[model samples]
Target: MLDATLKTQLKAYLEKVVQPIEIVASLNDSAKSQELQALLQDIVQLSDKITLREQGDAKRAPSFTIQRAGTDIGVTFAGIPMGHEFTSLVLALLQVGGHTIKLDDAVIEQIRNLDGDYEFETFVSLSCHNCPEVVQALNAMSVINPRIKVTTIDGGVFPKEVEDRQIMAVPMMFLNGEHFGQGRTSVEEILSRLDSNAGVRAAAELSKKDVFDVLVIGGGPAGAASSIYAARKGIRTGVLAERFGGQVLDTLAIENFISVKETEGPKFAAALEEHVKAYDVDIMNLQRAVKLIPGKIAEVHTASGAVLKAKTVILSTGARWREINVPGEKEYRNHGVAYCPHCDGPLFKGKRVAVVGGGNSGVEAAIDLAGVVQHVTLIEYGTELRADAVLQRKLRSLPNVQIIMSAQTTEINGDGQKVTSLSYTDRSSGAAHKIDLEGVFVQIGLVPNTEWLKGTIALSRFGEIEIDARGQTSVPGVFAAGDCTTVPFKQIVIAVGAGATAALSAFDHLIRSGDEEPQTTETKQAVAV
Candidate 1:
């Protein structure tokens, strides 16, 4: 299961273990069980503090638990934790064996003080890049509080449970057999959901923060660059984001990021965060800016009732996946309608699926799904595909791929629990058609996450923040960058450059408009709405 190089790395990581641990495997006479046994044996050979035991009768066969020798301070993996989850397995091993987690001390205390028993089950795909974060978070919480138990199940290994639960998305989490959340979630997010007073406490803390010289919204490539550049200027810089990494976290592969031959999205996002953390930037994650009021000291209001003031504000809220907005689409989201093909494609293996859009993302999704799914129907509203010629050619070469041009997706049909088919119309002939499928992957495009900024700042007809070459918006002392702004070519490299320009422009504005009076109570109330 693990190669020589991996074994060497595992051995090295195991050296950090300060306490004895046990790997208890529950297996049957199957090839997968045998493979898991071999893997566990190899792990035990590397560390004298580790031991493995097998039990034949268990609820989930071929599953295993990594626990501290006499305690339940560990996590469970129901499938082979390979691919993107390999790191998660290593972190779990070390954490269970008395290696301290790198989370904030306050966060560790919060987990330890939680009162109730929480059993978390997270369903994930091996190829899913977003699953590791959620798994690792819950695993860490479990280690902090034995009352919290985490079980990570591979959707590919246990198809029955996935279908029974009507799961069509990766990293779908359940609490005590009830749906908790879907997609990327952090430990703080989970805690906030569980604790009623968490939001109020966070809001109070944020309200007491001192005014920042430069406050950046969003945590994508653009916001990261802006924060780093501003912090380098020796000013008080802070970044507030609903979540760091933005759309980059959803991206699967990148080959055109300049100087780097190839890298994954999560990896690139991690590097960006690490680079920014090396500076003096104060990062506030899991916070969304609901309103922005411009003045001498601009006020950014959050959904948690926290109003943050800053000398200059940088808007880099970035963009989100564009929804089809058709009938039954919202009703069936995560029930069979998905936006990420890389994460959810394997769930529909040996089943039919549809990809909506004609652009590079849709064509690429079709091409990728052809290798895993039984069939793929590519639906496009345009007359022709807008992908690169090479990608179009590759998509055309696939035997299981079907291309439908000039077709508008009208509705996503579901059986109340999962998608059963999709409805569309022929744009040229005005003929309605429906294709039976198990999943629908929407890859139309992206819409700027500027809905909250509407009426507060000047936005284009398409809802993008209007900005000049200097990245300055219509509002003074306010700047915008990245996909949320009026920048051409929404690429990571372009966003990074735009972010730097915006930061410098902001500093220049601050120098020119020195000693301006703060907003009065009446002035603040006028725009507070």
Candidate 2:
């Protein structure tokens, strides 16, 4: 199962093993089990310190555990850890073999101090871009605290468990057989959920932070760029974000990023975070900005009841997938409604589904889902598909795809627990119709994340932050960039350039305005002009 180049890389990585480790495989007489055995055998050949053992009887066949020779520090993978999870498997091997985990020292200590037994089971699809983070996080915790056991299950491999649990989403997590969460989650978020006092402690710590010279309110490509540029100017730079990488984490294939011919979203996001961390920027993740009060020293209030002050604030909160606001849509979000086709398509294998849109994303989703699903019904509000001609042609060529034009999605019909059909209105005929299906994939455009700044600063009619050519907002020292701003394009490359401009504009404002006193209403209006 291992290729020539992969074996060489695996050998090199395994050489870092400071302690003996064992790969205990739980297998049966099945094709998947045979494949797992071959993979484990290939791994065993790479290092003398590594050993593999097979056990016929186990809860999940074709599964394996990577554990220290004599210790319980380990993590389990119930399927072939390839694709996006390949890095996760390698990290588990090294960390179990006594290699250091690349996490904060305080976080490791907190994991070790956790009191109870926490068994985490995460269901993921190999195509999912968001699964690795959650798997790696839980695996790291298991390594630190033996009481915390993590089992990553491939939804494609074990369809029975997925159906039994009613899982229609990738990276669906369960704690002790109960639903914990679904979608992208971080180690800090998991910790905050488990520990009651974690939020209070974090809030208190943030409240005591010194005023920043340049504080970035988002952590996407734009925020990363702004932080790097500001920090390079020898200013006190800080970043506050609900999560790093922003919408990029939800993205799958990204081939448009210049210099890099092709790369996955998660990988590119990691590089962005790594590049920012190389500087002296203080990154505060998992902090949501609730209110922004502009002044000479701007005050940004977070949902955790913490107030962070800064000389200049750069908003790069970015945008999110627009939801189809129809009845039963919110009720069955993860049950049958999904936004990402790459992540959740496998879960709806062989089931009929509907794609609600005719844009590029919608047509692309229909094409992708047609391969995995039994049938795909594409509904568009416009008379014609707005997708590229090539994409539209490919979608039309699909045998199991159906397209409906001049239709508006009326409602998503579900059976209380899961979606069963979708309702739409024929715009030209003035008639309504419902199609039977198991899932509804909404691929409408995106809405900017600037709701908090509505009353605080100038915003476009569409809610995007209003900014001048220099990336300067109407609030003088305050600036905005990326998808949150009035920037024409929402591409990552454009966001990076805008971030640089905003950072430089902020520096210029700082030097010109001076650090004397807070701006009065009269002076603020004058600066806006």
Candidate 3:
């Protein structure tokens, strides 16, 4: 089921193959095996350098293997590869066909220096945009380390394993049979975990730093932009983020970000990191600022018990999805309720799901989920949908989508294990109704990440930072941008612009106050990290 454009691209990529890849599929009585076999056949048929063969009986199939140049790569796929995971399959093929690895030298060295036998079992859904990055990283690492085996299981294909593992999200990596962290993980992050003597270091703590020229408190688009801009001005810039990429990682399709026609969230997030890494900024990932001190030299206290000092600070902590805190909502998370359609949509393929709220986010999620899910029931508390007209029109055009306006979600019904249905109250009729579904996606409003700055700065009732035109906060040396601020619109382009403005303002303040000083290139370079 390859499209014309994709087929052409794959053909071009395969033409460079110097070696043959033999796919060994273990058959089973289940239809999934037959479907996977058909897909493998189609892929092998497209290239002369590839071959497919069955290994085990239909009744005893458990695994599949691929061999390149007569050597097992130690790679396996436990289920059908589709959705976002399709990239993983393609990349695995390209690697098996002898394409040179594109990893950094340091990362490759890390992979080659590994000591013990490490088997990584990465659980992923076909729809998770962030899953492929981790999967491909592990797959590439496997190419270098024979002792390292990687098994990729499509969480959607085997629901029993998902429940057994208590998997709440995709890219839930397991190393040596223990749970590793989830979400978009980088190569260096994984190396740290494997090297940890204790349990996988949940997060790397930031060391105490004396002072910084510009300190950014978030890792989303705004924080990344601020750090890059400030560092370009020849100053010490530091970014402390709970998780890099912020809310942008939760987004699915981004057409409104200007210049780029289309891109997924996780892809864009990775690009953002790459772009920021090009500059000399000290990026402290997984560090959450628990407290803030405003003065000529602002101080940030992180949850890891490190105190960071800076001359100027920029807040770009970003926002999170507003949860519908009804009965059974929290308990059923990942069981049958999810907030990100791009991350979890494929897991509910051929199953009915519901979308809560009718804002732009909610409607967009419904439209996105409708393509993969069997049915989408959109529930809005307002009398009419508040989404953009174009999004509303597109959502209405979907045959499997149903709209329920002016209804309040009362309780989330679950089978004590997974979400089974949702109950709501009809505002007009004053009647309660229930909709049976396997998954529920919440896409209401966004709660700004200004809770830590409650008494530190001026915040709106919604918890957004109050910033003037210059992006300056109530505190003189502090500024804010992105969704955490009271900006008119919350968009990627706007956040980038706001970040630039905040950096410029911080530079101006340093110049006017005579706190700026010319430094040697060596000193400047040292602090850039």
Model 1, span 210-278: residue lDDT tens: 999899999999999999888766668999999898899889898998998999998899899999999
Among all windows of 10 consecutive residues in model 3, the one with the lowest summed lDDT is 197-206
Preferred candidate (lDDT higher): 1 or 2: 2
Residues 117-177 of candidate 3 have per-residue lDDT tens digits of 9888888987777888788888888887778888888887788887787675677888889
Q: Show where candidate 2 strays beyond 4 Å.
A: 516-529
Q: How well does candidate 3 match the true structure in TM-score terms?
A: 0.83
How much is the lDDT of residue 215 in candidate 2? 96
Window of ten residues with lowest summed lDDT in model 2: 520-529
Put down candidate 2 lDDT per residue, 84-181, tens digits, no spaces: 89999999999999999999999989888999999999999998889999999999999999999999999889999888889999899999999999
State the local distance difference test value for candidate 3. Answer: 0.84
Error of model 3, residue 458, in angstroms: 2.0
TM-score of 2: 0.96
